[model samples]
Target: MSEPEIRLQAWETHIEEFGTQQYGLSFDTLIKAVGKGPRAAHKLARRLKKSGRAHVVRIDYGSPGPWRNSKNFDEPGAAPHGPLWMFADRQIAWGYLEFDPGEWHPKASTAAHLTAVTELRLALTGLDTDPQVWTSERLLRRRLKTESGLAGIHIHDAWFQDFADPDKVWAVEVELSRKFGDGRLTRSLSAALEAAERNDLCGVLYFVRGDGLRRAVEGAATRLAHQRNLDRLPNLEIHDLDATLARKGVR
Candidate 1:
């Protein structure tokens, strides 16, 4: 792993270490450990979640954090410009919010959890094979880019290390997301492409949920994934939300 990637990995491991002792955390508490502000906190949180070592909860505690006289937890950023908390590992760890009760619901709990499992498992490499499972009503969270008061949710899943098709990693992101005008989905695809051009491990796979993006991104991703596999990584692939999930089970 590169220096930055190494550091990123270490930080996630740290969260897992601490998270094991606790159960969940508010953004404020995490700020102390990962640093303050949405970007920094988000960066760390995304890595933890993507790395499969943690689970993140977007808590709505009114406009500003500190949630003076708080009420209840809800969807992450459900009300905009709200504090989101990172909960680690199967509701067994904490990211920072150690005091507040995490937002809880039943409607999509099963699918949501399966989604988490599907996502985190992506980080696995080598012979970590377990039969793919089935899930429904799940969504692959999108990574946030550009600064905004209303930030898009950031999600991290897995990155594969490859050299034969350095740009192959880019295909993963390309395979995800059926549509997002103005390269919203393309940016990630580009990042992977750049990695492959450098001959780095292009094992990373991207999974985008929703339609339109499917034809657009997948059309390009499939061809690239096929070509890259021919060049190297015969077993690797760049798949959209459904295919990737189907490979695992539900989709």
Candidate 2:
């Protein structure tokens, strides 16, 4: 392939890989994924848009409501803030088109979480042992329905296979807020750990926002450890999300 073709192919792959998982990709996220400066990334996005492979969703962060197409900003009360790229009909025909922006609008927090997860996935590329493949929660849930022997398993936010070792897989959970109010967190963690063991995952990696959340997870792990044999349990690692993102220049 020619140089330009190669670059375009990489952009398309990145868009399909990340967009299918998160429903859409924020402008900044795309820029990071493509490893290009803003101007270059903008050009690439324009080319994709022109080819009818993608469309831009204008988001009004202040309004915290449904996103509209970039061409629909003339409507009354419309306040465009940022652009989110989604697959167009041409691209959607390739499959993995489970999300429909018109039918289901994501809450502001939900959108932010999805962006964070995408950013984390991009940041992993900077590591020595990056992820070879990433499976989002949406895909995991879909698999549970069709794949046998996956019943009664709790799905994590995402799962990734190690680039260095194809057999090594990890379950990722991104927690931005406290979800342990009524023993719910413990139960969720227990299920995830059990699922890891059953699926032969290397371990569970929890990316939590605050120290309090990290401590809560640690407390839960300690309790689980007491209940089960520690030597036989899979590894559980709690990381500070802010620190991790900062280290990767994502913050």
Q: After superposition, how far is residue 128 of candidate 1 from its true place, in Å?
A: 7.7
- Please report how far candidate 2 places residue 214 from its true position, in Å: 1.2
What is the per-residue lDDT of model 1 for residues 1-251, given as tens digits with 9 covering 90 to 100? 63344245655555444433223445554554443455676677766665665565554423344443222334444443444556656443323323223443222223233333334333222112211121111111111222222334323233333335433432233232143566554555545555444434434455555567555665555555565564433433544565554575332
Which regions in candidate 2 have their CA more than 4 angstroms from the true location? 1-10, 59-77, 81-109, 126-132, 149-153, 229-234
Cα lDDT tens digits, model 2, 123-152, are 665322222377767667666546755556
TM-score of 2: 0.73
* Per-prediction CA RMSD (Å): 15.2, 5.9
Q: Give the RMSD in angstroms, all C-alphas superposed, for model 1.
A: 15.2
Candidate 1 residue 51 Cα shift, in angstroms, is 24
lDDT, residue 223, model 2: 78
Q: Tell me how far the alpha carbon of residue 135 in candidate 2 is from the true structure, in angstroms, after superposition.
A: 2.6
**Winning candidate number (TM-score):** 2
